[model samples]
Target: MARVLSLVAAAGAATLAAAANPHAAMGGYQPATNVIEHSQIVYDIEAIQTALSADDFTEAKNIYMNGKYSCKSTSNMRNLQGFVKQATYDAKLNGTAFVDAFVDGDGPSYGPIPGSGGRLMLSPTFWDDFLLGALDGTGDFLGMSTAIRKVAINKGVLGVSTLYAAYEMESAIGKKYDDNSADASGAPHAWDEGWAFLYGSHPADDGKYSAWEFSKKRDLDFAYNSSAQAVEGATVATDMLLKYFLHGLRASRSGGVLADMVAARNNIYRMLALSSIRAALKYAEKAQNPYNEEYHMEAYVYFLVAANWVEQAYAGAGTNVLALLDFKKTEAQLSSNLYCAVKTELVPSYQPLGLDCAKVGVLKGHDDTLDDNCNAPACPATQTLPTGLDSYVPDVTTTVGS
Candidate 1:
C-alpha cells in the first residue's frame, strides 16, 4: 500500500508539472513543413502590391484573381475546428491571449489603421464586408476550401487549417441573427461579436499584444521561425489587408467592375489563409498552460482575426457580384445595410458618418488619417501619428537671413 501511494503521488506531481507548462503536453507547435503554398501566395501578393504602387490597377487585379483561383476547390485540412474548440477550452482554463500577445511589444504588425493593428481592437467594418462576400458565393471568398483541397492533394503538413473553419464559423454565427433587426442585421451583426470575450480590453492584461513575442522566444521547442523576410511576410501583409478594404470601398462607390477588382478580392482571401497559418504555428508553440486563464482567452481570441477577415472576404464576394451585374440600385441598398451594421453592432460604434453608401468610397484613400479623423468621436492625434512623429530630429529647413 505504501509503494502504491508513493507511485500515485509521483504521477500526480508529473501531471501538475505538465499542466503548468503547456509546451510539454502538445510537444510545442511544430511549424508545417510544406509552406510552398504560403510562399507562392506571398509572392503573388508582392506582385499585386507592386502593381498597385505603379498604378497598374488592371495588372494587380488580374494577379489577385489568379492567386484566388490558385487553390483547389476542396481542402485536405480537415477537422480544423478542433483547434478552435481546444483553444476555447484552454482559454476557459487559462486567461492568456496566446496568439495576440506578440503585438504589444512588437508594435503594429497589421496596419496604419487603428483596429487593424492589434488583437483587441475590433473592426466591425471588416466583419460586415466579409460576410457579404461569403454568403454571396460569387467566388472563393474565404479561400479555405480551395486551400484545404490543395493541402490534401499535395499532402502538405499543416499545424492547423483556419480558412474552412472560418467559413463554418461565419455560417453558424450568422444564423443566430438571420432575422432582420432594427440594429445591424444577419451576417454583419453576427460577425461583430466573434471575439466578445476580449472586447474593450487589450488582448493581454499587460495592455500589449506582443507582436514579436514568437520571434523573441524562438529558441523554445514550439516556436516556429517563418523563413520569409518582412514582418509577417513583409509590410505587404499589412498592405494587402488594407487593399481588401480599399477595394470594397472603391467597388461600392464605382458600381462597376472598374478593373480587376474581382482578382483583388480573391488575392486578399489567399493572403488571409497564408497569414493565419503562419501566425497559428507560431502561437501554438507557447500555448502551454491550460489552467492559465489568459492563455485560454488569448488562444480563443487569436482565431477571431481570421474569422473576421474571412467574413469580410465572404461579404466582398457578394458585393463584387453586384458590381459585376451592374445592379446599381440593389448594391446601394446593401451598402446602406453595411453602414447600419457598423453603427449598431460595433461597440463604441464606428463613428464615421461618411461610411454610408454615398460617402464611404469618397472617404477611402491612402491616407489613414481619414479613418483616424473620421471615427464617431475621432481618434486623438497622439494615438494616430507615425512612429517617429515625436522624437527629436534635425530640422531640414534653413534660413538664409535671420
Candidate 2:
C-alpha cells in the first residue's frame, strides 16, 4: 500500500509538470524548419517606389498593374490596388500636366515657382487647385503625387501585410498543428505565410521596402528626445515585433500551448498598430508648421491609413479617433488641438493592448500658438490656400540696397 501511494503521488506530479509545460510531454517533436517564400511582392513594391520617385508614372502604373508580383494579382490586395488607381487618376487629372511641363523646361513659362533643387515644380496653383483641393473633398488624398508616394504606397503595403498576417496567424492558432506536412492548408504553411508577408524572404530585421522598413522608420520618428535627436535603444517596436514573430513560429511548430501563439499574434497586431499610430502622430506635428505641401498631405494620409486600420482591426474602436482626424479639413484647418485629442484617444484605447504611451513619445515641432483653439471647430466649406504660399521654391530673394 505504501509503494502504491508513492507511485500515485509521482504520477500526479508528472501530470502537473506536463500541464505546466505542455511541450515537455511531446517527445521527439521537432520544430518545422522556417521557410519564407514571398520576396517577389517586396521587389514589386520597391520597383513601384522607384518609378514614382522618378516621376515615371507610366512605369509605376505598369508595375502596379502588371508586375509579376503585383498586388493587383493577389486577391487579398485588390482593394489596395483600387486605391492606387484612384490616386493615380486624381493626380494625373489635376497635377501631372503641370509637373510634366515643368520637368520638360516649361516651368519658366509658368512663373518663378519654387522647385526642389530645380528638378520638378508644378504651377503656383498646384497646391490650392490640385493637392489640397482633393484633400478638401472626401479626405482620401494619399498617392496624389510623387512627393507623397511613400506615404500612400509603402504605408499601404505595410498595413495590408500586417493586417492579413494577423489574420493568418489567428487562423493557424485555431487549427491543429501538422508537424509532418508543410502543405498550404497546414498550420505550418499558414505560419510561414504570416512570416513571409511581414519579412518576406529576407533575413529577420534586414528586410527593405516592406513592414520591416516602415516599422523601423516609425520607431526612429517616435524615439526622438525633446532635443529632436534620436535616442539609442529607444526604438523597441520593431524588435518587439521580430521577437513575437520568431516566438510565435516556435510555438506553432514545437507543440507548445496554443495560448502562447495567440499571445504572440495579439502582440504583433498591437505593435503594427502602434507603428501606424506613431507615424500619424509624427506627421500631425509636421502639419502644424508644414514646411511645404508635402507635409500637410502626408499628415492627412497617414492619419487616414492609421485610423482606418484601427477601426477595422479593433472592431470600430477607432471611430471617435477617426472623427477627430476629420479628413475633410484642409491642411491649415488641421489644428493642433485636434491632434492632441487624437493622442488622448489613442493612449487609452490601445492601453488594453499593452500600449506604452511613453514609447509613442511627444509630438515633434509642436507649437503652442497652434493649440489655442481647443475644439478644432469645423472650417469654411471651401478651404483653399493662396497661390505660392505652400509651394516649395528655392530661397532666392532680390535684396535692394538700404
Cα-based RMSD of the predictions, in order? 23.8, 21.4
Per TM-score, the best of the predicted structures is 2
Task: Score residue 235 of candidate 2 by CA lDDT.
Answer: 42
lDDT (Cα) of model 1: 0.25
Each model's TM-score?
Answer: 0.22, 0.58
User: What's model 2's lDDT at 20?
Assistant: 32
| Candidate 1 per-residue lDDT over residues 49-92, each given as its tens digit | 45545655455445533443122224422121222333443342
Q: Report the lDDT tens digits of candidate 2 across residue range 1-402.
A: 011122223323554321232111111111132222233355666766777677675665565555535232335432223322335324432222122222223222212112222222223222223322332222355434545544445444454444445445644664533342233345654655566556543222235667566777776666775676876434456767766765665566535556566556656655666776776666655655444455554554454433433443333345555455444456555554556666655554443444455555545545666456544333223212111111111111112110
Model 1: per-residue Cα lDDT at residue 159: 13
Q: Which stretches of candidate 1 lie over 4 Å from their true place?
A: 1-235, 289-293, 307-402
- In candidate 1, residue 393 scores what lDDT? 14
Best of the candidates, lDDT: 2
